[model samples]
Structures are given as C-alpha cells and as structure tokens.
Target: MSAFVDTLRAEWTKFRTIRGWVIGTVAIVGVIVAFGLMPGMQGSCGKNGPGSECSLPVGPGGEEVTDTFTFLHQALTGDGEVIARVAGMTGIATGEDPDKPNHTVEPWAKAGLIIRAATDQGSSYAAVMVTGGHGVRMQYDYTHDVAGSPDGVTAAVPRWLRLTRAGDTVTAAESVDGDRWTTVGTARLRGLPPTVEVGLFATSPQHSEELHTGLMSGAMGGPTQVTGTFDHLAARDGWTGAAWHPDVIGHADGPANGAPGAEGPPAPASGVEQVGDAMRLTGSGDIAPAVSGSGGLGVSITQTLVGTFVGLILAVVVGTVFVTAEYRRGLVRTTFAASPGRLRVLAAKATVVGGVMFVTGLAAAAATVVFGQRVLRGNGVYVHSAPAGTEVRVVVGTAVLLAVAAILGLGLGALLRRGVTAVTTAVLVIVLPYLLAMTVLTGDAARWLLRVSPAAAFALQQASPEYPQVANLYTPADGYFPLAPWAGFAVLTAWAAVALAAAAVTQRRRDA
Candidate 1:
C-alpha cells in the first residue's frame, strides 16, 4: 500500500511537472464555461404571457415546457370517468401557410380525453388519445406514455375513449365497438384532487418551425387547431349534464402559436376559452418528461453541458500521453526499475490521470451548471433548473464520466503503446459514438449506439429526459438517452474496466 502511494505520488509529480498537459487540464474549466454559456446567448426568449407577463421558469424538478392544447372540460368531484367517442381526429401540418397544399396530418397528431389539475400551465394529468399514426396511447403525469391500441385513428370510424379515475389511480381503455373495450393502461397519481377537471382535448402542434425554438428548449410549437369531431360524450357520476367549457391551454407553447390578428397576448399567454357544443379547442402543448403529481418546476436546469466533448477530448489526450509518453522517452525502463511491479505503475498512472480528469470535469461541469445558469439569466435566457440534489448528481456524475473515460484512454494507450493510435481509438470508442448518437443516428439506432458504445455514459449528463409515458416526440434528436443515467454510466465503466484489465494483462506479458 505504501509502495502504491509512492507510485501515485510519482505519477502525480510527473503530471504536474508537464506544462502542456497541466495547461490543457486547467483549460477544461474554461472550455466548459464558454460552451455552457453559449446556449444562453443563442436562446431567443422573453415572450409575453397574459397581462404583460414574460416570465422565465424558476423551479426544481419540472420541465421548461410550453404545453398548449384545447380542452372541453367539466368538473368532476371525487373518482369518476371521462369518456368520449371520436368521429375523427384530423389537422393540417404545413411548413408553409395553412392555405398551402403542402399541409397534411401527422401520424402523431392527437385528439383525445384528458383529466387534469386546475392549473393550465403545469399540471399533473392523465390522457387517452388517438394519434395521427400510432393508433391509441395513454399518457399520464407528463413523461409516462403507453400504447393503448395498435389500430390507426380514422375519420370514417369512431373509437371510444374512457378514463376511469379511482382515487389516485386512473385506468384508460379504448373500444372499437364501444362495448368491447381493451384496457390501455393504468396511471397512479399520488396527490390527485377529489375535484378535478375532466375533459375532451383536441390539439395539433404546428409540427413545423413556427414554434420550434431549439432542440434543448423542448417542443415550442404553435397550436395547429385540430378540430376533432365528437358526437357521444358522457361523464360518469357527479351527474350534471352541464355543457363542457372550452379552453385552450399551453398558451406559452410559443409566440407564433398564440398571436392572433397581429395583436399579441402581451402578457404570458394563458388559456383561451370558447365554450359550446362540438367544443372546438385549439392549443399545442404537451405533458411529457412528466411533472411530479405534486407540481413545481423545482429548478429549471438546462441539460446542455456544452463543454463535454471538448473536455473529454482533452481528457483523452492527457490520459493517453500519461502512459504513451513514457514509451516515447524510453522512460518505461526507469518506471519499471523504480516500481518493479508494472501493475503498480499502471495503477498509479490510472489513479493520477483518472483523478485529475474527475476533478477537472467536476469543476467544469459544476461551474457550467451553477454559474452558467446565472449567465443565461443575465442574457434573458432563463435556464430552468432541476432539484438541488439532481443538479448535484449531474455535476458530480459528469466528473465520474470523465474520470472513467480517462482511465479507459490510459489503458488503451498502455495496451496499444502509441499515443496517436490510442487517442484516436479512445475518441472513436468514447467521443465519436456520442457525436454519432446525437447527430447522425435515428432515435432507435441512436438508442442502440448509446446502449452499446462507451459513449453511452453521456446519458449521465442529461438533465432533461423524455418519458416513455408522455406524449412528446421521444426521439434522440430531443436529448433523450436510451438508457438511464447511472445505468448508462455503468455501461461505460464496464468498458473501461475491461480495457484496464486487458492493459494490465498485456503489461505483464510483454516487454516495455
């Protein structure tokens, strides 16, 4: 143990004595800071809400979302059911003007039944809807979504949608012939209100650039106003045959989504109501990346850790050189002569390189999340933060990712016995896969890549996640990692561990 400590000290001395590597490691903090701040500058925000309110989200554990849609709701006291039969769910999806021939309906465009909390902006709710393509689905809270039916929604045919609430549990089912119903799924809400709003919802996202701000900021689309025709609408118990109240929610979905006749809402956009039969509702917002049944956007932390790539590249170079430089300078003999146990030498190097990388990454990631959010706010790009604990995990988890990756790079260098080749291979294994997963791959393929590649660990840095239970487009392009954070990081750690084992074996078997 003393000898191992001595070797670690020696490795540390070597790292500190080198100017280029030290500088590069130090520069990681600057890279993270700069990159993290860039997104704030690029963001275009400050859209006015209802009554001259242009508010930025400030909370923990909630999504920085714009969930606008139309609802024809009636109040329900205690556990009850909201059921409706759909005649058709159709809407225009056009990149050009609505009048253009290019417009058409999207397969995912939805019209359905919803049960929600009173607050329109951010609420805990469950929905069963007919999609433009995916048939029928059950969405609850925000992020949890499940496929209810495989049959596609059509105008000629009508499908019955039912949402039965029993205390905290909501059961969703769909019927082709109204009597024979197939259970979609059940949602368990923790703090469901005895009296809640039950309604039929029809919404179509612009599905275009009108509301799209950026990939990280989430779906900012206009309400394409899907007029879903419903003839049979019934509520169970709490029996008041009151005419449904028509409300358009998620007004903050975007500017283009709400500006009518050129007169802006001027305040933060709120729900627009037009109540009548056929209950026409025009809104485009989503309940995805779900809200906790007890509401509040804990702290809106932007998930973008801009400096991850640059910092990893630096870690790779420094880590590779930590081992390869010894071979280049013919110093392996001296290192072996001093330590005798080559594994000790390798362990020392791994400790030094991995430790340095962890510290550097932790600092960079922490600063980026902490100070970067402030910078974003100063630039009028309020970054919605997550909970303090979650933020801490992200900041720390980033460091862990870098440390493991550095160790992987060091092992590869020792195994391959060359800096350039090792660095290239490390980057290919660690960084390239992340880039490809994020940019080039399809959602499914990206998921597979992240699942298998060493870079799958990048999921650890994702502060925002798309829940499968939610109705949002859960695509790789929208920052959704196929794996959970720690689980994904574990995969990378496995790769690193294997690489280190191989390096240890090769070091024992071969000459310097």
Candidate 2:
C-alpha cells in the first residue's frame, strides 16, 4: 500500500511538470469553437437573409400596381433544347437561377411562374409572347395567318384576356377557381403579329398609377401560393408547355392570394404616391414571416459539456509522457527500487492520473456546457427538451466516458513504456481510419468507418429532430442503421477494451 502511494505521488508530480500537453488541448478546443462561429457554418445560427415580400392588388382589372420587396422571376422551357429566361422590363430574356441551375427553362418554349401568391386574383402568362407593351404578356411571331371578326366584347366584369394575332391565336381562360375554365373574348384582328410581349395586368384605380414588377433572377422569390397553369400551343409547336412540366420548373399549382404572380406589378410608382399605392390593397394580415428557431440553452450546454469531456479524454497524453519521461531520464529504476512490487507502482500511477483526468473532465464539461449554451442562445439554436434528471444523466454519462478513455490511455502507456510509440499508436488507432475514409471509401463504407473512429463516440450528442440533412443520414429516414448514443459508446468502449487488454498483458510480461 505504501509503495502504491509513493507511485501515485511520483505520477502526479511528473504530469504537473509537463506544459506542452496543456497547450495542445487548449488549441484543439479553440479551433473547434472558432470553426462553429464562422459566418455560414452549417450549425451557425443567424438570420439567413431578407424574408420574401410581395405587392398587393392595385385595382379591379389590376392594371396599375405597386412595387413589392419580393424578389420574383420567371422560368420557361420545353421544345428542342433547354433554355432559361427571366421576365422583366424588356420582356422574357434568357435568365439563370443562381440557386438551382437545373430549374432553368428554354426561352419562349414553356412558361413558368417563378413565384406565386398564396391567394387568388393573379394573372398567368404563356411563353412565346414577349412584345406588347401592356397587359399580361408573351412574345411570339405567327408564321401562318388567320382572320377573326373585329367585334368581341369583353365581359363587363373585366375577366376576358384578349390576344390579337392574324392566324395563330392563344387564349388563357380563368374561372373563380382552378377547377373550372371559361374562354374570355377571342382576338379578331387583321394581319399576323410578330414576336410580342404577354403578361398579366393588375390595376389599382383607388390608389396609384405606375405598374410594379417582380424580379426572379436569384433565389426562390415571390409569394408562395400563386400558381400558374399552362396550355399547349399546337401539335408541332416549338413549346408545348408539356415536355417541361411544372414539376420540372419546381412549382406546385395552388390558389393565389391576390399577390402579383411571376414578374410582379409595374415598376414602383414615382414618389410619395407609392406609399398609398403599396397600401391601397389591404392584405389579409395573415401572412407570417419565416422564423428560424434557436436551440434551447440546455442543448448548447450539452454540446459544450460533451466537447469538454472529449477534451479531457485527449488530456491523457500528458500522463503517458509523464510515466515514460522517468524511464528516459533513468529515474524509473529508482522508482521501482523504492516501490518494489511492479503492480503497486503501476496501480499508484494509474490511480493518480486516472483520477485527475476524470475530475478535470467533469469540471471542463460543465464549464463548456454553460459557455456553449450561452453562446447558442445568442445565436438561436436550442437544446432538446428533456427532464432535469435525464439531463443530469446525460452530463454524467459523457464525463464518465471521457474518464474511461483517459484511463485506457494510462493502461496503454504502461504496456508500451516508450512515450512516442504509445502516444502515436493510440492516436493512430483512433484517427487513421477516419482519414482513410475521406478518399479510400464512400457512402456506406464511409459510414462504417465513422462508426469505428473516436469521432463516432460523439454520437451521444445527437438527439431526435435533427436538421433535415443530418437526420436523413444518421437515422432510419433512408433505411440506414442507426447507432443510438449508448450503442456508439459501446463500439468505442470495445476498442478501448482491446487497447487496455493489450496494455495489461504487455505490462505483466515486459521488464521495467
């Protein structure tokens, strides 16, 4: 017992004398925290950007309009080759979706509403009509010709949308709801019209004059509920609107809430009148801004706690070096002479080092949890809600694993004796597989590699309701096997067991 006590004292003194280990541990923690805080880091909690905005109806026919903050645009495709275009001042010109390039459609081929209103009273424009200066617009030229009677009166209710071309004529009919359809007045003009602009019109007779427009050159813009349905042009037309389905354009058809569809109302009216122009059509006030939820304080605390636990486990390198340093200095022989029984010396050193790592891990984890929670609260990510007792169990579990990992290092150090060899072997056993997975394997293979690495032990930090991307990967969402927190720990513990057993056998047989 006395010899064991002497061994413990010696181990404590040597560990305290080392400074490099402390620096390494601090560096790792600092790097991880800094990475998490980077502006667009996956877990970073911040306002992504401006929320979607939209202009309301101006008047009955909805000709005059107001400019909205909504960034809406158009996508058209179909026919021979794929094309992309945006609806704007000149007309539908080739445009690209910055966020989803695959959503691009061919110009004048098929028409699409890049943005729609959740309510009704919006207009739908066909592709291939990009000329006329007024009303819902599209651009097209008639190679063939036809003649229609000059007289077609629009319904007094301001419902019929009329197109005037000689031979080829296209009409879009809208009823009170999408389930029914009615023909507005047909265009009975004289000669064939060349490429023309076609667009829906919203007029605000009570408030303003200038038209408002929506620009869809960027991300998913415009109001969500406005849906645009299209009809086919002809048997052998350039754009049938069927080849490139609405689904291909990334739009789902639904009702509109009076917000301008596609490119919005005419450009903002000049000056002070604009305020009234925008406010003339009162909104339902039902629309809610998109809100990103912040995690609870408890979750942040949990992450920090776990991080600190892992940090302390890594701290065991100091103990390994401390023990081996004495041998390198030729003082271990004196230690053995003083201690006598080898087992007593090993037990004393293991107890002191293991106890220090365990206690330090617990404290560090607690401090990390507090600090991390505070930081996450400021950003908006929250922790999962669990009973107070469960939270305590989690905290204790994490710290215990870290404590065990540190002790495993001590056993390994005893068996190897040489500082560099043992430390390198320990680190390689835990780290090399993960690095190899980066290039040598992919998909399922990589997942298995992760399970075997020290990093897998961190799975204890995960909870249900994870981010969509993460949940898809780590859970049964896609038929992949999920290793629950404890299961993951068991895998890590098994590795530690193999290491510890090897160490014990070596220590028992090898000379001091």
Candidate 3:
C-alpha cells in the first residue's frame, strides 16, 4: 500500500510537470469560464421572473392554466415551422406562403411560435402555431409601414391572446418587449384535461440576407432564444394547468418496456409532457415548451458533460497514448522489473490514473454545469436548480465514471500492450453499445443493451422524481431489466474489475 501510494505521488508529479498536461488543464478551465460568462444570445430576461407583464388567457375547463408568460411589446416577429407531437408521437410539416410563388418559406420542424426581427433592416415578424393535443395558434404581422419604425410600431400596438382552458377559465395578456408582461384579461378556464405543455418558441422564415435581422434571426435561423417565467398564476384542481411540476411528471412512466416482468402503470392525466414534447394549451394552440422540465436542464447538461468526457478520454492524451507508449518504448520489462508483482503494478497505475481523472472529472462536471447553464439560459433553455444532495451526486457520480473510464483504459492498455490495439478497444467499448442500441434494439432487446451500457450508468446523474416508475422511457411497458443508477455503475465497475484481473493474470504469465 505504501509503495502504491508512493507510485501515485510520482505519477501525479509526472502529470503536473508535463507541459501538455498543464496546457490542457488551463485550456479546460478557460473554456469553462468563457462559456459561463457568455451573455444571452437574444436578450436578457433577468434572473428569475419579475420581468415584463404578459397575460395568458385561461380556458373554460377549469382544468388548465399557463405556468409561464413572457411578453414582447417590441413586436419582434417572423414566420417558421411548428412542432406538434406529444411524447413518442412523431410527424412533420412545413410553413410556406403557397399563394406567393417567389416568397414561399421552408417548413421548419420547431416546437412552437417563431418571432424573427431583422436587426439590420429592422424588419421582424412573430408567429405561433398549435401542433399537439388541444393546440391553439395566433400570429401578428407588422411592418414599419404600419407603425413607421420597428421600435415605434411595437410600442403603439398591443398583441393579445385569449387562452381558454377545458371549459372552465380564460386569460388574456399583452406585452411590449416579450419580457415584461401585463395581464389583459383572466377568466375561469373550462373543459380541459389535467395536464398540458407550456413554453415559448420563435423561428425565422427568410433565408435571404438582404434584410437586417435582430435577435429574431437566431431564433428563426437555427437556435433561437425562447423564455418565460411561471408566477402570478392560479389554477383549479378540477383541471390541469401547464405548470412545471417535477414530482407529478418526472417519474411518471411505465414498466421496463420489454423486460420479462417490468410493467409500468398507465401514463398520468397529463400523458407524459417532456420539454420537447408537443403540448396543447387552451383549446387550439400548441407549445413545444422549451426542453426545460423538472430536472430536464440538469439531465441535459450532465449528459452533455459525460459525453464530452467520453470523447476526451478517447481522443485526448492519456487514454489515447497509455498503452501505445508502453509498447513502443519497450517499457513493459522495466515496469514489470520495478514491481515484479504484475497485479500490484496494474493496481497502482489504475489508482493513480483513476484518482486524477476522477478529480479532474469533478472539475469538468462543475464547469459543464456552469457553462451549460449559461448556454441554456442564452438559448432560453430554463435550467432549474436541483436539490442540494442530487446536485452533489451529479458531480461526484460523473467524476467517478470518468475515473472508471480512465482505469479501464489503464487496465486495457496493460492487457493489450500495443497502445493502438488497447486504445481502439477502449473506444469500441465506450461507443459500440450506444450505436447498437440506436440501431439494433427492439422491445426486450433494448433493456439488456441499455442495462449494460455507459449510457445506462450515466442515467444515474438524472434525479429521478420520487416515483420514476411513472413516466420514464427506461421503465417501459414490460419490465425485464432495469438497473438503478448505482446498480448500473456496479455493472461497469465489475467490468473494470474483470479487465484488471485479466490484465494481472496476463502480465504475470507473459514475457514482459
């Protein structure tokens, strides 16, 4: 143990002194900080709520309500495609002026509503469409000719929408900047169900460059900023509102899908409303609701961070070079000579690499949160805060997985000896399963593949609602194989262990 510790110290010293390593660390930190500081690509909506006054009409059902309302009185609008599919539901469409032969716009498969404003020429348009269950849509087209100038035009005109819930309530509101909002009217909603999708969206219609576009260009062109805050809202229990509720929907899922015995309960009243899922508000309007839900932000960020780390380990220094260097330099003899005990040496290297990777992973994950949040915020992806403990687990678990990845690299390197062979093998291990799952898995097959993949282990970073069994994809209609987070991690750890054991046995009996 003492010798192992000493070797670890030596390895750490070697790591820090390497110019490449130092540069890499600094580069990572810099990227993280830069991402953290990026301003809103569109416009600042302020921290949390307390912005503009925009009103949302309640329906008649008394069963639905709008959780968030952002009003843009400035009238930055444009035309584009709309998304209208519920969870697991799929389809496609386009938005073009068929009558205008030369001016027809391409159809964009976006969630809902697109407000594009040309910053240069000051031309803009905002349009919203319904695509999901009980969807509604409204649009306002304005030109400087109407109000004289874009700025002055929005100031004089107030856009209003009447939202009627499932036959119980109605709400009306107006806005100037799409940020500050004011209620225009509110009536009890009527004749609606218990759940709905609520969020903001915008897109562009023109591919031409002759016009000057403002914040609307981004929203319309590719990634647009869509934001809204949920407050000053009232709801009737008899009807469901489009409020964000992690507890009610986060865990709402079915069985283990094709698992032999996994059988999930039926979907809840809302019928599985995820961020990207198309949702209907009031009676005829629809919303894609930015992909921001319960722990949706955290889950998305964590997934991205883990994926980044996986890419780094496979593409960057240590993971790529560990085994190859040993083979190329003929250092196997010396490595074995110094330790004599092959397994002990493997253990030592694994500890050192895993520890460093683990610590760095924590830093990377925290950076991911910071930068990811900034990106999400800039793009109007609401990043909700996670509970304290869950946040900690997210970081710790990510780091641990990183460490495992590194350890796996070290073990595989030792076993294969040829750095190229080992690195290739490692990359295959990390990437192959996901590819297979994407292409090969069907009903029951998905469970087995998902259970053993890194993707499955990473799912642990997700803070499952208290009742995850309610509405998640992992718990499908049939329940045969569903490994919990730690359980999945254990499976991965076992893989590492077996690999290490194999390396040890091979090293002891081989020529090196």
Best by lDDT: 1
Shift of residue 13 alpha carbon in model 1, Å: 2.3
- In the order shown, the candidates' Cα RMSDs to the true structure are 5.5, 19.0, 18.3
Question: TM-scores for all candidates?
Answer: 0.81, 0.44, 0.48
**Candidate 1 structure quality by residue, lDDT tens digits, 273-354:** 3335444444454444432110112123534576787888888888888999899899999999999999999999999998
Q: Kindly list the per-residue Cα lDDT of model 3 for residues 81-103, writing each as its tens digit.
A: 11221111122112322233343
Clashes of 2: 63
Q: What is the lDDT of candidate 2?
A: 0.38
| Top model number, TM-score | 1
Model 2, 344-421: lDDT tens digits are: 666676676656655655554545544555555455443333345545554555555555556656666767778888
Candidate 2 local lDDT, residue 226: 13
lDDT values, one for every candidate: 0.70, 0.38, 0.40
Candidate 1 segments exceeding 4 Å error: 38-40, 47-66, 76-82, 94-104, 117-119, 165-170, 186-194, 206-223, 252-283, 290-304, 436-447, 469-478
- Model 3 regions lying over 4 Å from their true place: 17-312, 315-317, 435-447, 464-482
